[model samples]
Target: MFNVYITKAGKYLPNEAVSNDEMEGILGMINDTASKARRIVLRNNGITSRYYAIKDGIITHNNAQLTHLAIEQLYDSRFTKNDVELLSCGTSSPDNLFPSHAAMVHGLMDNRSLELNSSSGVCCAGMNALKYGFLSVKSGNTSNAVCTGSERSSTWMLADKFNNEVINLKNLEEQPIIAFKKDFLRWMLSDGAGALLLENEPAGDISLKIEWMESFSYAHELEACMYAGGDKMDDGNIKPWQDYQAEEWLKQSVFAVKQDVKLLEKYVLKLGAKSTKIALDKHGVSDSDIDYLLPHVSSNFFATRLYDALLEEGIDLPNDKWFMNLSTVGNVGSASIYLMVEEIMASRKLKKGQKLLLIVPESGRFTYSIAYLTVC
Candidate 1:
């Protein structure tokens, strides 16, 4: 049987750092409104700063360039163009609807001659894209593949739009709940990119053996939490999700203005833990077999809730054994798990012969992906 192993992990975060103060200032927050919101973000997410592709109040790097930089770092001298037989990428935001992010990255790498796959949707697209690449290797279609996930989340956020409207906790009773609810996540979202070079046979000194990978999407029955849909046209009429007659979505702008926080808090961790248990049981992976846990909890508050839920399920993972950089990176959409893997592997925290479970739960599309990795 063929096996796929992650040979190299790499990540790229914008050099431009955005602090909580900077975020509040950008949103045009005034008086104590910014402080109150900042406190909530800090208390809930434990994020103080995150990098962005913005410069002088303008977005500089698009999704494609970010992914390219990450992949470039993955190449390092160990792997070359010939070693990469397939390229797969995924993102919620893209540079262009055509050519696909993978094709654009292929063009950037000057590897137009090779095969590429680009998928677009919500945050779960990243996990799906990697799964596609994993299948590509397990099926013997390719010996090596480069999988990438990148996002310029700042561009898709609408914090600046609701800056003046957000009320402070001091005036909690004075404003509508939607105002604070809508503003909660936008400020915490940041930007980054992550890439991984995988092969059937290990090429580098370290490798993460692919033991099990599966994704479960439960959004069909759940209401959309955060999304990018049709914005208003010149006449102020909202376009449909996709417009076939016009050949364009007419989405002059797509942003998240509202989210169901109650819905998210209600089912996110419970469903995520259930999915984790399912994968663990299916693969016969025991709690004792796991040496590390990499969980991409979108918010810091969810982190505690998820920990409690996992404990109830009888999987007690210590805090030190869990690796997360959300405090510095925020929620990077599809790029979250990739960044986790890159940081973990590069930090030397992963020794040979350790089993790690990567838990990725995306509220944007109500999906859960649990990947069991054996480090060697």
Candidate 2:
């Protein structure tokens, strides 16, 4: 089999860590609904703090810039930008529709010679990008590739539609109770970027070696589970594309993630358990053989439930083997898996030959991907 390995990893966490208590202030003091909503989200989501990459009330970095900085953090003077043969980028939040985020990163690097690729929509965008780079190397299409999952979630999370500001508590009881599903993530979603460098074979050193990867999509049935687009007018039509105004749209066009709690309760855990089995069986890996579990669930609500579901599926993983950063990082969208993987590598606790199972489920386009990695 062709060899593909991740040689290095890096990340760019935002400058500010907004705690739950602090977020209550941003939600305004209009009524108790905001306070009650905050408690429900944090309690259910398990996010004590999350970050925002904002500078003077503006987005400090785009998907390309965030990923670019992350890749730079893994910089090796010996292996310059010229050594990179290809770039594969994935993101749900891109600066512009055309040019692709990968191409934009190339432009930001001021190095346009390398071939570039990108995948968009959903949190799984980043993992999908990794798959492209992995296959490229495995198929002998390219040797040195940079796979990145980057998101400037703060841009959309704080968009005008959901971020309502109230001055004083004059009419505290007048405001309606918030539809938690519609606005839950305006505060829950954090911002950051993460990256990994891959090669056909081990270079100077290796972080993780690829064993097998499997991804499937249920987008046909799960469309609009999480999405971003222009708002429709009351006249039962969308504003003409040419008439679309950026300033107005930026304020009202929120990236919404509204899911029926029952639907998630019914299928979320099953997807995680089933995907784990599918990937492991395809590669002939026994459930008892796993040394670690890196789950990319959006919240602790799902993480806890998925843990039990895997047990029912006969994969009894110990608690210590489970790795998650949702409490501190929140849901960083497409960059969640990359950020998790980068942090694990930085810990340097893994010994050679340890098998790590990375479970990825993206609701954007509803792609479920599982990656098997071994320490080298």
Candidate 3:
């Protein structure tokens, strides 16, 4: 098998950074009233600023465009877009349902025809895309691959999307306030895209050698916790958007992202830590061997909790070794990990032979993905 290395990392955060106080202005207030949960959620998530792809109710860049922009930055003296043999993309929010996200991204690229793959999930989708690229190169099926993760959540979080629900509720003389489940995500998510170019050989003076990657799902024992484009049934099943009538779509804000906060509190860290221990043991990598911990923490609220959970599992990595950028970038779902890795690589803090452990936890039915890399 060939050894695959991440030769370059690129990211594109759309437009300017929007501060916490300016969020409601861009997203607009629901029902002309500020959200009661926005401040509380922001305080807990610890996000100071974030980006948006919207301006005056018009989308500046769709998910495909954001991804294309990120991929363009990956080109340099040694590698270019046309040199890619495979392209794998992942995202929680795609521009359309018919054309796969990868296909749309490829359509925007000024490159030759290449193999494409699109992974669909919440946060773990990005890692899954990277895994596909790594394996394709390892098996000698391709010499190089470009993997990306991006999100354009602003399109769904706009106040106009929720206006219909408010109108429907007011018509019935009910409270005009949207549910906390729906309002909670508005202040928590932002727009961005990140990409990685993987090649069979290490490039430049620094490259990350992918040692191993593992994924685990507890869906067999858990129910969905975070979702969109569907409604959750009482029996723990998600009813797809197509299952409901057209009128109910806007009235229910069916496409707006929602989460069961209680479920996330119960399982996200516990399941993630357990999976980390399993992957470490399976690969014979001890916690002490990890020089850096790049965790895709959705919020700062879970940072201390996750550190303690890993301790409970006999993995005692210290806080100094942890790395995250959620506070400045906001939660970009699948793109979070890629952005973190890109920032760290640009920082030039990594030393040769150092080990990097990446953990991505998704509360969507309790899923986790772990990857191990060595600096070369």
> How much lDDT does each candidate structure score?
0.76, 0.74, 0.93
In candidate 3, the residue pairs with backbone N, CA or C atoms under 3 Å apart (3 or more residues apart, or in different chains) clash, namely: none
> Which scores higher on lDDT, 1 or 2?
1
Query: Between candidates 2 and 3, which one is better according to TM-score?
Result: 3
Give a tens-digit lDDT track for model 1, residues 1-376. 5899998988899866778767755544433344355576667788877888877776778888899899888765667765688999988878887878888888888754777888777667788789888999988998888998888877655344433333332345554223444556666677889998878987666899988798887766675555555443465344556553342322122344345577678888888888888888888887889898999887788887888999888788878788998988888888999999998988887788999998988776578888999887
lDDT of 3: 0.93
For residues 1-376, what per-residue lDDT tens digits would candidate 3 score against the true structure? 9999998999999988989988998999999999999999999999998999987666799999999999999998678777989999999899888689999999999789999999999999999999999999999999999999999998788899999999999999999999998999998889999999999999987899999999999999999999998989999899999999999999999988999999999999999999999999999999889999999988899999999999999999998999888988999999999999999999989999999999999887888999999999
Query: 307, model 3: CA deviation in Å?
Result: 0.3
- For residue 140, what is the lDDT in candidate 1? 93
Q: Count the backbone clashes (under 3 Å) in each candidate.
A: 0, 1, 0
Model 1's TM-score against the true structure: 0.86
Off by over 4 Å in 3: none
The true-versus-predicted C-alpha distance at residue 220 of model 3, in Å, is 0.7
TM-score of each: 0.86, 0.86, 0.99
